[model samples]
Target: MKKLINKLLVNHSLIYKLFLYIATIILVVYLFPKGGQFKYEFQKGKPWQYENYYAPFDFAIQKTETEIENEKQQITQNSKHFFEYNEEIVERVKNEVTQKSTEVFQNSELSQEEKLDLNTRIATILATIYQYGYIEASSESKIEKAAITLRKGNKIEEIQPYKLFTSSQILNFLNSKIGTQPYTEVQNQLLNILYDAIKPNVSFDEVFTQKTLEENLNKISYTKGLVSENERIILKGDIVEGENLRVLNSIKNEFESQIWSKSNYNWIVFGYTILVALAFLMLFLFLRKYRLDIFENNNKVTFIFFNIILIVLLITIIVKYDAQYVYVAPIVILPLVLKAFFDARLGLFSHVLTVLLLGFIVPNSFEFIFLQIIAGIVTILTISELYKRANLFISVLQITFVYFIAYFAFSIIQEGNASNLNWEKFLYFALNGAATLFVLPLIYIFERLFGLISDESLKELSNTNSKLLRELAEKAPGTFQHSLQVANLAEASANEIHANAMLVRTGALYHDIGKMDNPMYFTENQSTNVNPHNELTPRDSAHIIINHIIKGVELAKKHHLPDRIIDFIRTHHGTSLVYYFYKKEEEYTGEDVDESYFQYPGPIPFSKETAILMMCDAVEAASKSIKEPTAQAFDALVEKIVNKQMEDGQFMNADITFKELQIIKKVLKKKLKNIYHLRIEYPE
Candidate 1:
């Protein structure tokens, strides 16, 4: 059973991928809020374009947000504030005042009768003030009316029209009754005496007030009067004003909220499944037809599907939470990122599929799809050569502008006037464009996650200032210069043949890093023409030369260079015979020599980029030996050397055509001639 399962997994991998892809999309769709989707798209202050609407059943009209807010305001304003009577505060103030009066009388030089008269007056004044409630001034602003409880010995009575006194009012009442002139010092003394005694008998009850307000607000009906079955709700061409638009929106919401019958749900799910399946099927078919390379690789296929699903899921989340800012979701990043690694067509296609899936959940499906599709196309057109920093900035700018234009045009069409256009939406577009700039960095992350390479990474690796390449120039200037010449030749040839010029150029730069290990032994770096090979036997010299390839692989691995770049080091020599050393060995021994002793340890060039690097390396090095340094001599040198390498079956594994090889030969001949100061057909 396990063997059978393994066989099934291997044999039906594409089917499994398709199943998973479909399942993921369906899962994301199910995760979205199924009720928010509305069939008709409407705008306020615009005439209803659809046919006359009617209520099919006795459904209540949903209230507008403005109406509900107005009702809540009424509830808040009319709700009476509750106040609790604190008899302890009143009694404490009275006791404090009595004690203060006693202290003042003791400090005064008045007789007992005068002090007694002053105490009696103070007691009368306190009684007058305590009769009214003293509330803290801060609480007075928050209360419209207060429910005050007056108590008289075991009997409680509720009072209305009770005037609450603030601290200032109490002081003012005391001063007016006690007389302000001639006894001003006494009055001031008494005011300071009463400062600590003033307290609020009535305190605002926030919990009670809030609870009452909420209960009142909850009593306000959310739904207005019901429309009977088959009643005409609104006629065609009627301008949807505040109340009418609210009713229409409410009916639409309630209609969408209703669940399908249990039996009918199967058909609904089936229909929804078919629609989504068709959309994804179109995307899959597009890949299968035009992008079979990506379709064949399961990782690339998974990456595409993952991006699509992620974008859709984000839109779904936005739609469920806040649909107005859906434009801020950075949908354009999809095309921008895909185009960064892949081509414009695949990027644009994937973006369209993502937008189409999102349309099911967002309001106004047609407008959403139209705007996103146009923005995606703009993204593809403006974004080119993303490796350059300026290109990304300019491309994002253009994409933002396109989004603004498309949205503005749609709004004008929908509203029939520019006056009603929501300009704030353009801010979301700007944010999206800014967010899309992150795709540049995200491209690096995607490369690591997917084991893919992009032009931006290639450009960075190709920099001469890079640590490894800089070390190569400093340590082995001769080999460094040779690598540069070969890079130019390979890049030119790759471009002519419609190959990855950046990849081939990068490969050429690092192809000869192994020569850096023994730069002095190579003829290019020797200043005095002292040959290192002279002291060594032919076999020893051959051994040193052949070991460079192996040393290069180790160095490349140590430097953490990509395997693609290391491939050039492994295949550049391509098991070719070291002709000079082998000939010398034959002359020294006068016997048939072992070919393995003279051949490079190689798997040979298995790709066009590595093959091109091999040819350019040999051609550039041999061109320096041309004594005449003329165009004809350079041409002869290039052809003779390239033909011999070809005859040795070095290029058998490389996926290069004969026609491409001829183009490469022509480019190399021209480049070599230019190197020798010969004026070829192509000008500098």
Candidate 2:
């Protein structure tokens, strides 16, 4: 039992990866639509790929989106708008007008016949205005010069509304009606009082109108006609066009929607799970084969998985809400982030696979996949350095352009004209490009969350004026200068062999920071002829020399440097001996000295950058001692040192090839000869 637990603990990383893959597969499969898929693939302009197709069941032909939209719009346009006739308002206006007219006539200078005739005329005019109906002010736009239907009690009548008036317009309407007739001052006063008493008797029936509109919209037939069973839809080698295309799509929809039964639903889910699992498996296999270094670290593997899942979830959610906006989700962000942290190949590969999965959910699956895959390729190719703001902006612009061009090409092929292109999709692509710029800050966020480092961070760390590098210059000027020379050499060597020059240069700058603890013990910081190591025993001097690696690591940690930079300090010396003191101790005692006391505690170089630093560091420090530098002498020195380090197994763990080492050796020799001017100005 104890042995089994120990074995489990030893292989914990593998187990974590297994669990991660399974969980990712399950989550992505769950995100897929539960509906079963149609087996046939059809396109409008392309010939039918399947055998002669026929309607297997009695399913009705479905309407296109444009057809459905047109139907609903026609319902809104042709259907009459209804307005309510307020009987209460009309009745109130009648009583007030009659009472006020009687009061005004009581003080009139007219005889009874004149008063009665005037009262009858007023009543008739008010009745005419009310019969025409005054609509509410808020409903003006709904009945905007259009014919309105007036509903009074249980009766409905359609009216032209040529004389409709709101509350504000009532006074002008009353004046218009009475301005033609001669009237007494008392008669005019009564008309004014009746004007205040009348209210808008017509109001838009908003609730009823909306309810009717919805009912009409719902009653619209989504299916125009039905296809009989066993009817030949289209023959093989026939281009699907017009009604034939519509019928085929209708049958596919009906088949997919109707076939989702209890037994088949689980089968669909299982099939999706298998496909999704296979995609993830391919990604893992590619990582293990091509990126073994990244594959070994579980953190990096988890970070990669997180990025893939991030894009998948983002696109999936947007598609679920409205598939029309799927292009605006910024699929290029996946490759941008991965390329920033890892490499372009991995980024592009992951993006392609993830997008293929999204094709199942987004509208226009073929167009979407092709556009995104091409965009991913463009993103990886254009953006070499992510730290520069201008580079990212330009790359994003290029990526957006690629998206636009690919989509335009596809649109023209299908529609056969640029006029038929959906220009609205170009706006979405522009937004996608704009959103891709967020990768710069997003990378910083990833760096913080995952404890990862990127080119941006490396650029910042490589700055010579930073706090740590500045301190190294102040306390140990010679070592600082030595680090600078090593940085230049390692950077050049890295570039020569197609390795990471920026990373190698940055690592070289901090590799000797450990020597800052006691600068005089090493010869580099000795300005005056006083040596601090003369009074101490050989072992003591060796101990002080070896402790610098430990001290540098502590200072780096104290200053919160990333672990990637700290690895350089730890592995620069690679367990090589402090041979100067060991030889002196042997001469003084005439006996063998213990090698352990003179050796640096090392984990060796584990990457191309670190291994290059190891070679350059040793060569640069040793070259300063050559008094009579020559081409032959520089070549001999570089060869001897690199060969000695290789013999000591210093580069066994590093991912460096022998051919790459030869290239680096040539670069170092050329650089050394150039430093001392041994080589001529022109190469032979």
Please report the candidate that would top lDDT against the real structure: 2
- TM-score: which candidate is best? 2
Off by over 4 Å in 2: 136-142, 163-182, 678-684
Model 2: per-residue Cα lDDT at residue 367: 83
Residue-level lDDT of model 2, residues 476-535, one tens digit each, is 999999999999999999988888888888889998888888988889999999998989
Looking at candidate 2, the ten consecutive residues that score lowest on lDDT are 175-184
RMSD of each: 5.7, 3.0
Clashing pairs in 1: none
Per-residue lDDT of 239 in model 1: 86
Using all chains and alpha carbons, the TM-scores for the candidates as numbered come to 0.78, 0.95
- List runs of model 1 lying over 4 Å from the truth: 1-23, 35-56, 66-85, 95-132, 140-163, 179-196, 232-248, 259-272, 279-283, 474-476, 493-500, 516-551, 567-615, 633-670, 678-684
Model 2 / residue 142 / CA error / Å? 4.5
